[model samples]
Target: MAAVPALPVSLSGRFKGSFAYFTIKDRLPQILTRVIDTLHRHKNEFFEEHGEKGVEAEKRAISFLSKLRNELQTDKPVTPLEDELPDAALWNQYLDYQRNLPNGNGEPSWFQSPWLYVECYMYRRIHAALAQNPPIDNFDVFKEGKAQNFFESQEAVIALCTYFQELLKNIKDLDEKQLQEELFKLLQVSLWGNKCDLSFSAGEDSSQKSSPLQSLENMVPYILVNDMEKVWSLLVNAKKNRTERSNVRVDIILDNAGFELVSDLVLADFLLSSKLADEVYFHGKSIPWYVSDTTKHDFNWTIKQLGSANHMWMSRCGINWEGNLKKGVWVFHDHMFWTLPHDFSSMSEVASDLYAELQKSNLLLFKGDLNYRKLTGDRKWEYSVPFHQALNKFHPAPLCSLRTLKSDTQVGLKPGQGEQIQASESEWMGELIFILRHLIELQ
Candidate 1:
């Protein structure tokens, strides 16, 4: 793919006299102030631990963040300049889109550009925040706490793996109808897990704790399961039909860790038990990503969670889940494919590799908010645009996006549904949940 264009020179003027002024004047400054404070708090500790090199790196990071904040505030519009990474291209695209929009009344700033732009900008700002802060600057604030928790719970990881192995032992005994019901239960558990993710909201009351699996319980029944069932039958009925050899693999683009991973493991186990897929491949982020992304250690920690005798659900499932792991029917991988920017250009560049890996799978299940944002190219689409159209042919496998909308950019809404949502709810675009399934052949 050719290089993306630079940010337009007109963006500064576009925001200067408009209501969107908060983005520059208040929001950006507030973010910068917090960043600087975070940096100052950790500076001494970072220096003491790493010596001169750490101190110098922290200083340079702080300087860059300060300069970037100043650039945002300046009267002179800054056009895009090349950066060391392709992620910069997303910001450049945002600037271009925002500058070119026809000014009109009642347009929201969040809807003025593609979803990818705002999501990428948030990530960049988070990166800036870390850079400006010392010891914390060197660490990913999102992942550090989670990683620490995983390391401290080694026993939990082993037990979960053992449970999965045992679950596999009972697969041959389940009838088709029983298998379907079991799979639906697991899907419900996976859907509910989205509620636990912190990105959605910071609790207003310190004492209130949100259920991690709430959304799943709400969304599972709404899933128009005719399609999901058809897909399931296609995989499971292959032997009886005898028309072709069935060698199906299901890929789960994993989301959070802890309970979320446990829910996903439950779903994976069901898929194998139902004969919906012979094997399951879990794809995880390569970097410390969106708070609870699964690392190698987290993967092990999740397995342990599933096998523990004290885990009420696992004990009740009455299957030896651990046997599946030992048989190599379940596998885990962390790949760089996830770390790249969400754009058509980036998707196209990586298509060949993605296709190669996914060619072996019958279905790819992308979970949670960030994965959904990336899959849709994070662009603000006309509410009527078909979900497949927004994907821009990036489907490497027949895919199901099970997401609780945390950001905008939804497609496939029924006529007037979008408008009705806007009228009734202040933040419907980000609060609604969806299970958008697209078959490669359907496109």
Candidate 2:
């Protein structure tokens, strides 16, 4: 077991502000109240739409939610909880353990859990908070100004579309080798960019908001010069070994919207154009989640934004965008699999279906900080633990994680690296970003 670092004597003022304003005092309870009311308002309608079993499930869900809301509102003792729901027990256990941890103040704050559990807990708690705090009898937990700012930022969107146009044009002249090299460079850029993207400090906008792709307009020289060679070699080797002519499919478990989504799309496009993948499947949130997770609407809007650019660069990519969507090569799925209360352990139950679909794909890319938290089950892992070990049995497809560290759970650090970071008195695990890729065939 890894020794717990000595606790800081006083919580960082920023951390305190985050909990007081976002998690415990303001946003969470409000969100939970809205979720409860939504359930009640939708209960009869859901039953009418689905029938007896659906109604029963809805009722039971509402009951659990109501109790959860009450607990948050009253600041009740952490209940001895378990996720014994036939399908998601491990996830439940994780949550239960997180709630049971001792917070710095010796009273458990809702925010004090392993990264994965606390994040999910926050969302669930928000659902309950929204349910309890109805606004004139309607649920509107997502009324923050930033989300609106993102959608309204037409100039930023246009700038990204223009960039994509230029990239698409440049790709036409590249040989297969060059394409592969470009893909790798984009991947690194995407990975490094994540470090700047998470909300590490309270009151600060995430990296996605602060530095959009437009910020990188001047850095292309460094990217092409520094990252191109190694990626080219890897791509050449990968191509040479191909036995059967198989199309590579890339799956992205997507994250945040506005600028972050644009960056993700840029990388995805590079993968496809470079012949790294023939198709891209995007997995998105079922409901409003994580304050920034993409939804079906968000996905479509992104495509439209890319297509709307009149520049030649945008037009070339744009012309082919809808075609890919129609060919079923670019797909989006929003099943409960995404919103499952458990961590990747829940993947086991749906392994057959998930594996079948992913088996055809060459790579499965997971994005953002929250997904990283979930992938590792947000355990209090020794930072030195191997990534694969922390992943336990959840390996499916040739996978890579692109995440900016936002939470405490991390793995795959070098010897003594974890200790060094700790000695610095900095939030190293939470601020450093990583890109870990593993090919299933190699293992």
Q: TM-score per candidate, in order? A: 0.68, 0.68
lDDT of 1 by residue, 151-217 (tens): 3433433344344446557767877776676565556556655544533432111111333233345
Model 1 CA deviation exceeding 4 Å by range: 1-115, 121-138, 145-172, 202-227, 237-246, 295-327, 344-346, 436-443
- How much is 38 displaced in model 1, in angstroms? 6.3
Cα lDDT of all candidates, in order? 0.57, 0.56
User: What CA root-mean-square deviation does each model show from the true structure?
Assistant: 7.3, 7.8
